[model samples]
Target: MLVFLNQRLVVFSTPKCGSTALEQALAPMSDIVLQGDPRIKHCTFHRYKWRLEKFLQIFDDTPMATTALIRHPQDWLGSWYRYRHGSWLDGTPQSTKGLSFDQFVEAYLAEEQPAFAAVGSQARFLTHPKTGETVDFLYRYDAFDEFEGFLEARLERQFDLDRVNTSTEMRLSLSAHLAQRLETCCEGDYALYDSAHAPRPKSRMRAFMQALAS
Candidate 1:
């Protein structure tokens, strides 16, 4: 999580999203920086809205312009699978050494997900559990240029993002059947991702209101 108090911008860290590179580039400009611990770094939108976002209102009491990136669901699980399959976690329960991507996703869809497949749900992370509100700005992970343009305009400085923390140990693909099942079961995940690409006239007004308030 990052807060640019002057800009009234809060950039949420969605796991397996390109947050590390953004943090490296934007940390110096942010008034408040939260990183290091995965939980803190990957703070959920709801947690921020209900807890920290409200707390920060003590300083500047207006709804902040928030932003987050979301990736395709199948690719997200692939990242988790490839990451845990690395040599570092070879012996741990979190290791995914022996499993194929299909099996890994199978475990993920299990009622009792094993440690290796316990990656948190992206929808839940970016949503208010009570009100079902998500971030103010949602962008597709693949279509990062649109977000970069927005940030450059907001921060008034052009910045380049470098690739970091990628999971390239192996390339794995999910079977078509399992992919369909994942899509069916994790409907919200797909919907959240789809929203990133949807037209957002309401969000533009929200951003306008935020600018006026600030």
Candidate 2:
């Protein structure tokens, strides 16, 4: 996660959403950059608002504007499958080397997911559990330029981002039945991505402030 104190912006790093590239590009310009562990590096918006932001209040009282990037659920799952299939993870329990994309996705949607398919939901990362509030800004992974442009304007800096931690390129296809199941299981992810275009609601802002105060 990258926090720009002057900008009052907190960019949550959503998995498989090109966050690594953004971090690398903006780290030097950020006031605080979290990159020690996966858990801390990719801290969720809800967690930061409820937990970490209180600590930051000693330094700054500025209400942070949270942002994140979200990808299509199917494509996001495909990235995880391909990433685990990489040579570095060849013999690990997280490896998806011998599995087809459909098989991987099936395991992901299972009641108890296997290690290789246990990636957490994007919706859950961005939403507050009790209030059902999401980040202040969300950008679609497919429309990366839109997000980049907004970030540049907000930070007043040009970004030179290189694609980092990209998975292997392959044409991934899911069976119709499996695709339907995935859609049903990840409906919240799809809904949240769709809602990104709308303005943040007053209730969401109120809930966020309440959470911060609590």
Candidate 3:
């Protein structure tokens, strides 16, 4: 599960998965940008029109690490729902408006677009490119402490726990209805999630997810 990411990292951020916080954390380390396509907020492809490896190599040449924060599909779906429909009920600014989670998922299923697609998926980005080699490390946001520990040890630096734990709230609670709906709307992703064996609920995964979300 640990593959050395050619020394440079590219975090393939899925929307509303705490990618912003991670970008901020690593931002201080280098001048590189963590976004895939600025014009397309959620697009996986870049303006350069390169495949995975070519895009990856562009960053591999830099002194930066290409990394992104990913979250549990169930949790991420909720977050995406909130962000798209309105801001956090806690008073954060809303980013997008129009469409309920159900509606959006329906659109995604029907249109097969980026925002609607890739739910419950990690394999495409988490796996290797050439030899199908994955990254040196696939840090699970759910395993925050361990992941931070791994980073601290690797970089020989201490990270701020208070800052790291910012905005740690489950946007939506797990519900049977939501799960069933998600399974129906995102069948491919649901299956892929099972195949990937994404981390289950636990304090470790919770902490990691919090770090990435903030």
The residue ranges of model 1 lying beyond 4 angstroms of the native Cα positions read 198-214
**lDDT: worst 10-residue window of model 2:** 195-204
- What is the alpha-carbon lDDT of model 1 when measured against the actual structure? 0.89
What Cα-based lDDT does every candidate model obtain? 0.89, 0.89, 0.48
- Give one digit per residue, the lDDT tens place, for model 2 in 38-147: 99998987788788889788798878888889888899999999899899998898999999998999899999999999999999999998899888888888778778
lDDT of 3 by residue, 12-101 (tens): 544555555555565465333545463333334232224544655664654434343455566656665554553453333333245455
Sorted on TM-score, highest at the top, how do the candidates line up? Answer: 1, 2, 3
Colliding residue pairs in candidate 2: none
TM-score of 3: 0.53
Give candidate 1's total backbone clashes.
0
lDDT (tens digit, per residue) of candidate 1 on 99-195: 8889999999999999999998999999998999999889988778788888889888998899998886665777899999999999999999988
lDDT of 2 at 76: 90
